[model samples]
Target chain A: MRSYLSRTTAIIGMGLLWLAALIEIYPIILVVFSAVKSKPELAVNPFGFPKEITFQFFATAYDTMHYFRSVSNTVLIACVSVVLSAAMTSMAAYAIVRRKNRFHSFLYMLFLAGMIIPFQMTMIPLYKMMVDLGLYNSYHGIMMIYLALTAPFSVFLLVGFIKSVPRELEEAALIDGCGIFQTFFRIVLPLLKPALTTLCVLNLFSVWNDFLMPVLFLPDDKKMTITVQISKFQGMYSNDWSLLFAGICMIVLPMVVIYLLAQRFIINGITAGAIKG
Target chain B: MQTNLRQKWKINGIWLLFVLPALLFYLIFLLLPTLSATYYSLTDWDGVTSTFIGLDNFRAMFQDRLILASFRNTLQYTVSITIVQNGLGLLAALLLVRAFRGVNALRTMFFMPHIFSGLVMGYVWGFILEPNIGALNNVLEFLHLDALKMSWLGDPSVARWMIVFVSSWQNLGFSMVIYIAGLQGVPRDLYEYSDVEGASRWRKFASITFPLIAPSFTINMILCLIGNLKLFDQIYSLTGGGPGFATESIASTIYKVGFYNGIEWGYGSALSIVLFLCILLLSVTMVTLLRRREVEM
Candidate 1:
């Protein structure tokens, strides 16, 4: 009787998880279904499959939203910001971990302090500065801001990973007459690949999906990133459910593809960061 | 040797070089803006003007009804969503801890919502909750439950709760994942020993499982509090603080006051300073409290 009860409980647990999964995935499926339906059909059959699938909504959303331009802008910003942030963070981490000076700990703590302050606190003044600097609608301005905002956590993560590298490896390279920069580039960095990949994926997702920063700082139509572009599309096409879903599908597809491709690393990176914190 | 001294200097200089780029970016972008926000909070400079009136911005903030409304709304959303999300997450974790076939796949599916962007999820759910042609209302109508088909995102009373529900749905997966990790870390031997001693399942869970996952509870609570406190993207895309200022949060209010409405720069800065202090103090207090509990355990 005990064994039977345990089995039944297990079955019920599995049922609950399945229900949760269905709820989690329902929106994505609904968005796709709505994206293909005509306007009248979407209103008529909100939950059912479309009787006829047409590509017109996709065409309209694409044209009105300027989907290609927004995609390029998002890709450019995320890529450039990730590269700059990774390089800067890793280099700084290398210095702090290897040198182990009094000032190093102080600086590390300063970066960690940045993590506690919410970004909302910085938005107002940052917007004012951007306008004053004549970078209110420029790609470089947004990219630079992202680089700065992402640097602290990237630095924190890299510092923890870099500290784990054996000192003997660096010492051996130094004994062989390799310079400090040479040691970092050739010997130390190669061993830090796992951490590097993790940071790259994490930073990529954040920079790509970020809406608030781009909305405030890059509000100009031509300079908008994907998230801001989608917001604009929603604002304009608020009554047109099909078109809105198409826009959502366009914005979500790339991230979904990327996540599927690097699921394991992404999972590891998130769990590692959480458990360590 | 003299050569060794020169080598040491070069290494130190190179180390400084390595730190320069990140430091330069942080100083110019983050530190400068944060400090300027503090300085601007003391003034009455509109965003476009050069004039300053010291401390008037903050003095005005205390008198503004909209600011007070936003503070209340933000606190309401944060506290409710944090409690519900964490509660549901813990329940889900408890259920998932018992081994079953296809459990790993179930875990992945449960976590999938967390991986999606909050903006996308908000928009998707916005469609789902629309009163006229939303799937939710249609389902309710088909079920012959007309009384249950109230305006989900349109009514002031219901809108805040709807936002809470969406926020919980988006975040519960993350909390569940954390709890699962915590649950797995608890040794199985404790459960077995309790079973041998004829402890009921409830007693074993209360005694063994609860204390062990105290650290997880602390971490999850702190993260949920901070994340919900700074909520903007989801609220922005979903409601835009609509139905007559019923759902305006601190971040939304700051954005409106600063950029959208009329660029009240000093006022916005004052609000930002208040938010920063609230987050800072809350986080410190929470960490201290949680750490103290961990020690007691």
Candidate 2:
């Protein structure tokens, strides 16, 4: 009787998990279906398969939303910010971990403290400063802000990883007449590839999908990121579910592709960060 | 030789060169602005004129009903969503802990939503729950439960709840991932021992499972609290804090007060300061409590 009860419970548990998974995935499926369906078809049968799948909405959304321009902008911003952030954060982490000085500890704590302070506090004044510096509505301005905001977390994560790198490796490099910079670039950075990829993926998703910063700082239409661009599409055609879903599908497809391609690294990075920190 | 000192300086120079760009950006963009915000919060500046009215902005904040309301709304939203999301996450994590087929795919699907922006999710749900010709109401009408169809985003009473539900759905995967990590750290021997003792499932879960996952709960709760307190994108996209400001969060309130509604910069800075302190205090308190609990375990 106990065994039978346990088996039944296991089946019930699995059923619940299946239901949760379906709920999670249904929105993506719904958007795709709605994107292809005709307006009348959407209204008549919201959940049913499209009578005839069409690329009209995709083509319209692509042009109306400036999808390619926004995609390029997102790519440029994410790539630039990731390269700058990774270089600086890894160096700072190397210094702090290898030196182990009082000053290094203090700086490390300063970055950790940055993690706790919410962005709302800094946003208003940051905007005012950007405006004064003529950096407002500029891509470089937003890129600069993204680098600053992302650095602390990247540094925090890299510090932990850097600490794990064997001291003997660096000592060997030094013994072979490699200077600090050479040792760091030729040895330490190569060893830190996993953590660096993790940081890049994390920052890529954040910078690409960020809404508030772009909304606040880059209010101009010409300077909009993809998220802001999609928001504009929604605001303009609030009732056009077909076009809106098409816009959303366009914005999400790249992220979905990236996530699927690097699913293992993303999952491992998240799991590692959660478990350790 | 004097050249050795120059060599040391050159090494420091290289390090400084590597660090200068990031440091300069962070200092100018992040540190300097934060300091200016603190100064502005003390004055009566409205983004144009610079009038120093020391603490009057803060004093005025104490009497501002909108600020108070935003605080209450934020607290309520944060508490409700954090509890519900983490509860659902823990339940999902527990079920998926044991060996199961297709668990990996299920985990992947469940976590996929986190990759999308809150703005996108907000727009998707906004369409799904539109008052007229919406998918939700259409389905409800088709099911013959016509009375169940209410203005989901328009009703003040239900608007906040809808935001809560959407935020929870977006964040459920994040907490689930954390709890899965925590669950894996728990030992198999403890479960086997509990089974051998013929302890009921509820008893085993109560005694063994809950405490083991306390660290995950604490971290998830802290993250949820901070994230919800600063939540603006989802709320902005969905309701724009409409229906009589029923859904105005602290972050949205700050944004409106600062930028949209004629730049009440001083008052907004004050509000932002309040939010910062609130998050800081709550995070410190949570960390202390959780660290102690971790020690006890």
Candidate 3:
């Protein structure tokens, strides 16, 4: 009798989770379905499979949103900015971690404090600065903004990781007649892989999906990132739900694919960053 | 001693070289703007020219009805989102603790939303909640629950709730992941110990599991609180603070006033400063309260 009751409870638990799972993916499923369905089909069979699978919606979305150009721009911008931000911040973190001095400690605290100051506080002046520098629509300008915006957390994360690294590794590098840059490029960076990977994945998701910097700085359609392009598309094509679905799917596909491919790394990296904080 | 001093100066220079780029970026992009926000808040700056106005912007904020409504709505959002995300997350984490077949797939699906930006998720939900031929209302009609179907974003009262719901849906997976980590930190032996002694599941959870995961609770709450307080991307895409400022948050209002509207940059800075103060106060208070509890535990 007890076994029967326990079995029933287990079944109920499984059933509840299944319902939650369905709810979680239901919107996503509808979205993917909308990507292929025509406007008439979408209106008629909002939740059902499309009667005719039209590839034209995706093509129209691609041309309208400039998906190819915007995607490559997003990728390049994220990659370049992440590389610069990671390099600079990791170097700063290495110095702060290894060189124990009052100045370095103050510097560490400064970067730490930067994390809490809301970006809204900086947005206005940053916009003006970008315009004044003739960098409003430039890729490098956006990259610089990203580097600045992301530095604090990247520094904090790297500082924590670098502190855990043994001092002897650096001392040995020095003894081997390695330059400071070489030491960092060779020994420290390779060692900082896990933390760097965490920062990289986090930054990729953020920078690619970044809207404010892109919206304010990269106003030109030719220079816009995927997120900015989609927002612009949404604003103009508000009534075109079918096209919106296609554009959104295009925007979401890379992120979803990356997440699926690197789920474990992404999860572990994020969890580590969280608990460490 | 002279040689040692020279070596120290030389080593410090090299170290400073490594630190220069990050220092320059932070100073230029972050520190300068933050300091200027305070300065700009005092002046009637329009990005081109400025005149010292001396707290007029601040005074104006207290009289602004939109600001007040946004504050109320944002506070409501922060409180509700924090509770629901953490509660639902904890429930999911607890249930999923014992891995079964397809647990990994379910976990992946749940967390898929977390991978995308809030902008995308908000846009996605914006369609799902559409009044006519939207998936949500369609589901309601199909189930013969037509009464529950309302204009999700059209109604003022309903819009804020819908924003809250979308924000929660987007972030719940994150909270769940955090809680799962917390749960895993709780040793398996405690559950085994309770099992041998035949403690009720609820009792075991309350006595052992809850206390063990208190740190996770603190982390999740603090994160959710800060994120919701600075809410913008989702609101920007989802509602644009509309159906007549129903779902407007202070963050969104700042954007509307400063960026989109392009007239009230000084006033925007003042409001942004206020929002920062709120976040700082809440975070500091939460840390203090939670830390005190943690020590007692």
Which candidate leads in TM-score? Answer: 3
For this target, which candidate reaches the highest DockQ against the unseen true structure?
3
Full-model lDDT, candidate 1: 0.85
DockQ of each: 0.70, 0.69, 0.74
Q: Write down the TM-score for model 1.
A: 0.96
Candidate 3 structure quality by residue, lDDT tens digits, A40-117: 888867887778888788999989988889999999999999988988999999999887889899999999888778
After superposition on all CA atoms, how large is the RMSD of candidate 1?
Answer: 1.9
lDDT of 2 by residue, A40-127 (tens): 8888888666898888999999999998888888888889989889998888888878766686788788777777777888988898
Residues B77-158 of candidate 2: C-alpha lDDT, one tens digit per residue:
9899989999988887877766668988888888888999998988888877887877788889889999999999999869
lDDT tens per residue, model 1, A162-232: 87789998899999999888999999889989998889998998888898889888888888988888878
lDDT, candidate 3, at A24: 80
Please state the i-RMS of candidate 1.
1.4
Whole-model alpha-carbon lDDT for candidate 3: 0.86
| Per-model CA lDDT versus the true structure | 0.85, 0.86, 0.86
Relative to the unseen true structure, what is the C-alpha lDDT of residue A180 in candidate 3, on a scale of 0 to 100?
86
Shift in Å, residue A54, candidate 3: 1.5
Residue A153 of candidate 2: its Cα lDDT?
84
Q: Which stretch of 10 consecutive residues in model 2 chain A shows the poorest summed lDDT?
A: A267-276
B1-297, model 3: which lDDT tens digit per residue? 999999988987888999999899889988988888888899898877889999999999889898999999999999999998888888888877667898888888777777787887788888888899888888889899999999999998889988888888888888999889989999989889999999998999898999888888888988899889988988888888898888899888988888777767888888888988998898899989987887887
